[model samples]
Target: MKRHARITLLLFFGLWIGSPEGWAQTTESGFVPLLNGSSLEGWEGDPTYWRIENGTLVGEVTPTTLLKTNTFLIWQQQQPADFELKGIFRITKDGNSGINYRSERVPEVPYALKGYQADIDGQNKYTGQNYEERGRTTLAYRGQQTRIQPFTQGNVRELVKNNAWTMLTVEKSLGEAEALQSRIKTEDWNEFHLIVKGNRLQHFINGVLMSDVTDLDTVNGKKAGLLGVQVHVGPPMKVEYRNLRLKTL
Candidate 1:
């Protein structure tokens, strides 16, 4: 009877230790992959401007471009109210590329016509700033020609590098007030992190906290929709994006 009791106790302990919660704690961290790296199987974009080349997502621009057939690589997965997005990008030359969040497709207008863009322009004197799509210009700098306001000068300066991989992160929140922010580091491979919830937003670059802007009036009343990558049409230009990833909050 004593031996049986001991065996029963041991069995119960073993089962408890091997329960799902114990196993899940380590495997269920927040990090989730947005891009599968094999193909654009889950994403939709204009074939004319977006493609996966050598495992890096490439967005190309050409002269004499028209609004018709303009391409944007969109995340097929829809997000809820709160989440974070991070990615790495490299711009080959002077052009424009931006990350669009909470965006919807308007057949007659540009993809960003209703979303917020963590704006990118290698040629612009002020790069890596937040701009409200089809809304008020939130930030602007570098003379009237290039403008950035909400994001700090240090944040933009740190995130962007000349012809090198730079980390980019954008965070948004829907709490008491709406907000949006971003950061970047120059000339080195860095990490970009963003947090979005309610109407508040935060941005980080290579683990450095950059901006914390609030009171954002995002499209669609702060709900989540599609995340997109943009390649502005202009003189021939190319941008490479890889290790694209995201996680929900």
Candidate 2:
């Protein structure tokens, strides 16, 4: 009887160790602040567009400074492989921007990056989509859980587009896109979170899961690269980011 009691206690302890509560405690810690909130110290970008204003990272475009191409403000510290990033962002009514991760720089173009982007816009039309900049284009739209398959001639009928470059198969719908968009506050601060591990990428907006993607196209998918925030080529607008934190996994 004592031996059975001991075995039961051991099983209970083992289950507790691997429980959701245990994982939550560990995963919630170890976050390090990425922004100083006072200056752009560990970052690189076009001086004309990126700056720190009143303790917030700001990117602005005016009538005179209309951009011919998108510009990015890159983090110079490290190119994280598996990590979780959390930050708060606000933009004007017509602003368009995104957070780029596991990306590479375009040497010919100043402050340009190409990789996966957590798309953001003032209209909430694409506030939480996974877009591959200068690559496969849209990997997953808002409220989607998608798998990116390698482009092949055999699956041409199932392809999303005309070419092999765009082959995203929707595995399931996470939620209604309009319902998810309602969680975002326009022209106000909204939280954005990203969990990137291996080929799986998940994006959340305002603490709600917005889009998820599993990239199987190893030939075109990126595993590790730089981190950046973009100021897309558009009308006069402003965007601000704060409380940028990262926890490497």
Candidate 3:
């Protein structure tokens, strides 16, 4: 009888030790949907400029309602430290938009984001790059694996920007920026992938590596902030995003 009791206790302990805490373990590592197909309950933005239509998050800039500055639709739920974000996006001609992570909400600008942005343009020109909004524009360009070094000049914190802000050199070039041009579907949906961990950031489009940036600037860099979607300031255009998913690690 004592032996049987011992066996039962052992079995109980084994089950307890082997069991998972919650459904997070038993299920596959599924990505959480940030944008619900029906409503924009957890998001904040300008109603006239942003809305949900046919299950997609849509942003539009019309001729009469031209924007003076770039604006964003921010996710109010959470601010992820290390994560992977992905979605399907398609923009019209001259339309430009971005996925901004670790970004600060500018109350003065009202829906403007000020931090690292994953840039994409309608002309397929600036797609797949790390851009610092209002801090340092164009931290890394397409097909670039870059590292930023402090500029030695007194009180000058960042590396110099020659006329344009594309001075950061590429450490490893997986492919050229032009290589991704043909790969991006102009009028159709294109997949965007962004991964951020520690001080490293990488951007990909349509399964191709676009740019990588290693941010060592601690004082100016952001460790945690909100995620946002951009509708750039320019001519009238429309952009749509769907199937937005995020996974934190």
Number of colliding residue pairs in each model: 31, 0, 0
Candidate topping TM-score: 2
TM-score of each candidate structure, all chains considered together = 0.63, 0.84, 0.83
User: Which residue segments of model 3 deviate by more than 4 Å?
Assistant: 1-28, 150-169
Ranking by lDDT: 2, 3, 1
TM-score rank order: 2, 3, 1
* Better model by TM-score: candidate 1 vs candidate 2: 2
lDDT of all predictions, in order shown?
0.54, 0.85, 0.80
- In model 1, the number of clashes is 31
RMSD after CA superposition, every candidate: 12.7, 9.8, 9.9
In angstroms, how far off is 19's CA in candidate 1? 40
Query: Which residue window of length 10 is worst by lDDT in model 2?
Result: 18-27
Q: In model 3, where is the ten-residue run with the lowest total lDDT?
A: 19-28
Indicate whether candidate 2 or candidate 3 has the larger lDDT: 2
Tens digits of per-residue lDDT, candidate 2, 1-249, equal 699998886675542232221211112367887778688899999989999976678999999999999999999999999999998888898999999999999889989999999999999898999988876777888999999986544443344464223567899998988889899999888888999999999999988989999998877788999999999998999998877889999
lDDT of 2: 0.85
